[model samples]
Target chain A: MRVLVQEALFDAGAELNAFAKGDTDIGAVVSFTGVTRDVSGGLSRMLIEHYPGMTERALTQICEEAQTRWSLADVLVIHRFGTMEPGDNIMMVATASRHRADAFAAAEFLMDYLKSRAPFWKKEITADGSEWVAAKDSDEDALDRWS
Target chain B: MIDVLYFAWVRERIGIPKEKLETTATTVMDLVEELRAREERYALAFSDLSALRVAVDQDLSDFDAPLSGAREVAFFPPMTGG
Candidate 1:
């Protein structure tokens, strides 16, 4: 599948290479993987929440828009939901194109849109308490750069 | 009638992931007010409107926008996506 959003974690290198092989015209592939961090003072897990029907729709829309904006051969996005421990793979996005420019730009655009526009929420579990994380001003500012 | 959804902490407070409600609200704020007045749980969920974000038809939108023809509306805490 071009887009896969699930509750299970995956290996980034394996999935990316597996999806980008045997396409002679695909000269470049750019990918990004988000991984959970190991912090000494945290609760030990990250909780991710997303709307069922709407999550898939929003992802498809974002991927379609990226394809339109860039001359890419294929795009793959994987985002994992539910409770996850530190060091787990949270998400990945890969873009394949005939040239490096398109692949690079499309991959960056996907992350920008996903960060600002995707409908996922995360809560950080700390040693003493858990807190809902708020959207960062930096993330909003990043989207503004594209606009 | 519209199907309203809640996620994350908003869902925890509201005590439901989704609900179908009948309303004649012309704007999102109007619907929020109706929800807030329904009971204490709703009030707590919507106590601070600024902390809440909304989406109409799966696209993020502001609460002041009219909901005259909306089929779905979602409420959740300010997004921490990335």
Candidate 2:
């Protein structure tokens, strides 16, 4: 398991390749990448703020929970902070397991927890001004499916 | 002294990222009340507890959580991470 909280951009494809390499026991690998989206037409950029120590701890706990619930071979979570423009990759989650079901389920579980549980907040900057992105009720509801 | 940290708009409103403060509060809510009484900025920042979340010792916790032996506390809005 690897959890990375960084400001530097990462290549999703490269990370996936590296994650899948030398894993003979795993028969399936699933990856998800979250990209900064221009919700408004005038989106200039996004500023992601995170609690330095807690962000890592929360993400690791989420990943560990996923591993415990699923028979995962490996898990990789990389989340970016600081400034980013639309279309930039904000984060990625990769899960490897002996079967596709476990990999897919663990990946989704990780995403759902990361969305609400992680200590990162995003503020969208646009031509109008900057506003912090509100946590959606739907995102919170998404966790119910897992529980 | 316990380290108090704020993030996002809370930090913007509080005008600082973190601070070391001595307090006699035993719970997170009590500490918040103490901070709110300190300045108008803190009062405004903490005016709506529904819009805020708390962490005690870097773990997500409740406003009523006990602060015994806690070294750090943080306040922020609900997370919107992915």
Candidate 3:
């Protein structure tokens, strides 16, 4: 298991390739990438703020939980902080397992938990001004499916 | 002394990201009340607890969580992470 909290941009394809390489026992590898979105037409950039120590701790805990619930071979989570433009990759999660079912379920579980559990906040900057993105009720509801 | 940290709009409103302070408050809510009484900025920042979330020692916790031996406390809005 590898969990990285960084500000530098990462290549999703390369990370996926690295995570999937030389794993003879693994039958399925699932990867998910989150990209910054321009919800409003004027979105210029996004400022992601996070609790330095807590962000990593929470993400690690989420990944560990996923492992406990699924028969995963390995997991990789990389999340970016600081400034980013729309269309930029914000984070990625990869899960390798002996079967496709476990890989897919674990990947979805990680995403659902990461949405509200991680200590990261996003502020969208547009032509008019900047505003912190509000947490959606649907995101909170998404967690219930896993429980 | 306990380290108090704020993030996102809470940091913007409080005008600082983190601080070290001595307090007698025994719980997260008690500490919040103490800070709210200190200045208008804190009061405003904490006025709406429904919009805020608290963490004790870097773990997501409740406002009523005990702070007896906690070394750090953080306040922020609900996470918007991916």
Candidate 4:
């Protein structure tokens, strides 16, 4: 299991290949990459803010919860914070297991939890002004499927 | 005394990221009340509790949570992380 919270741009392809390499026993791997999207108002940038200590702790706990709930061999999570262009990558999660079902379910679970549980906040800086991204009720409701 | 932190728009509104506060309030809500009474900025930031979330000692918590020995408390809008 590996967790990284950084401000630097990372190559998602490299990370994916690195995670999928070796591990002879693993039969399945699932990954999700989140990217910054442009707002209808023309996004100039997206500023991500997070709690240094708490972000790491909360992500670790969420990953552990995923492991507990699924039969998985490994998990990787990388999240970035700082100023980013609309096309920039925001974060990624990968889960490996002996079964595709387990890997897919766990990856989705991680994404759902990360959307609301993580401390990071995104502010959309558009042509006119900047506004904080609001949490969606749908994101919170997505948790119901797991329980 | 405890350290109070704000993030995102809450920080923007309050004009500071964090501060050391002297408070006798026991619960998170009480502390929020004290902060709201401090000035208009705080009140405006905390105008709607439903749109906000709290954390005590870096752990997500409720407003009714007690601050018996907590060293830190954070207030922010609902997280929009992915």
Candidate 5:
């Protein structure tokens, strides 16, 4: 069972190593990591909000959707919600498959869905006041690539 | 009746995070119109529908989509969280 969500330390190297352990048939594992930014011109930390049951459901749905669209052997999605400092890993997705193309596409697809369709929200604590960050057009553009 | 949630700037504008609303509408747009008519705060919060996004039962949905049996509704700005 691939771990989908957790609220603890995420060691990227450990995750990849564990994913590939004794699985010689799996040729590729593509991964993406999202980190909290230190300088959004805001306060030192980022406050993330998400609907409890709904967030997990939404993320699982996106991962499943990616699976349906690609030939993926396994999918792992881990996202952290709450106060985060700069350089903290915010989210990570790892896709494994027998071929490199499928692994890469699944990883990209998962990220695109995460950026646009996920239910998480982030607020930047700034000197003036805490402010909600808006969705980036670049993210939308990123999602468009697979459409 | 449905539980409506507001987050981020929507909460700041509406001054609340969650509310129980009773309505007979079948679409998200209907709920928005009703909330906008409630008071100045709601109106201001929902003034620009283009800037907001709705989730029906936690799945992102469009404003005009039907909401006949939705147990929950959420209004928030476009997701900025990672």
Candidate 6:
């Protein structure tokens, strides 16, 4: 298992290939990538701010939980923070398991948990100004399924 | 003295990212009340507790959680991450 909290960009394809090559026992690999979106159509950049002291531990905990619940052979989580233009890759999660069901479920579970439980905040910078993105009730509700 | 930290708009509203405060509060809620009574910025930032979340020593916690032995407390809005 690997958890990375960084400001540098990563190649998602390389990450996936690297994860899949290590274990021959794994039959399937599932990956998900989150990208910044300009919902209002004029976003100049999205600034992601994360707690400097707590980010790595939080992500590690989340990945550990996923590992505990799933029959995963390998797990990788990479989340980026800092200013970036729209369409930049924000984060990615990959899960490898002996079966497709386990890999798919674990990947989805990781995405849901990271969406609301992680200690990161996003600010949308547009042509006019910047504004913090509010947490969605739907995201919180989504976590309930895992509980 | 305890270290209190703020994030996102809570930091912006309270005018600082972190501070050291000496207080007799026993719980997180009690500390919030004391800070709210200090000045308008704190009051404004803490106006609605429902919109905020708290962490004690970097672990997510509730307002009613005790502050005894905790060196740090953080207040912020619900996280928006993915």
The candidates score, on chain A by TM-score, as follows 0.94, 0.98, 0.98, 0.97, 0.89, 0.97
- lDDT for residue A65 in candidate 2, whole number 0-100: 97
Candidate 4 true-interface contact recovery: 0.90
Model 2 DockQ class? high
A1-147: candidate 6 lDDT, tens digit per residue: 899999998899899888868568989999999998999999999999888778787888888999899899999999999987888899999999999999999999999988888899999999999999999999999999999
Whole-model lDDT per candidate: 0.87, 0.97, 0.96, 0.94, 0.83, 0.92
Q: Individual DockQ of the candidates?
A: 0.71, 0.95, 0.96, 0.92, 0.67, 0.87
Against the true structure, whose lDDT is highest?
2
What is the alpha-carbon lDDT for the whole of candidate 2?
0.97
List, residue by residue over B1-82, the lDDT tens digit for candidate 4. 8999999999999999999999999999999999999999999999999989999999999999999999999998889888
- Please identify which of the two predictions, 2 or 5, would achieve the higher DockQ against the true structure: 2
Report the C-alpha lDDT of model 2 over A21-85, residue by residue, as the tens digit: 79799999999999999988899999999999999999999999998999999999999999999
Stretches of model 3 off by over 4 angstroms after superposition: none
Full candidate order by lDDT, most accurate first: 2, 3, 4, 6, 1, 5
- In candidate 4, position A39 carries an lDDT of 57
Report the C-alpha lDDT of model 3 over B8-53, residue by residue, as the tens digit: 9999999999999999999999999999999999999999999999
Cα lDDT tens digits for candidate 6, B1-82: 9999999999999999999999999999999999999999999999999999999999889999999999999999999989
Better of 1 and 4 by DockQ: 4
Instruction: Estimate, for each residue in A3-117, the C-alpha lDDT of model 1 and write its tens digit.
Output: 7879987989899879878889899999999987755455579899887777777788989999888998999999888988988899999999999999999889989888767
Among all windows of 10 consecutive residues in model 3 chain A, the one with the lowest summed lDDT is A14-23
- The alpha-carbon deviation from the true structure for residue A55 of candidate 5, after best TM-score superposition, in angstroms, is 1.3
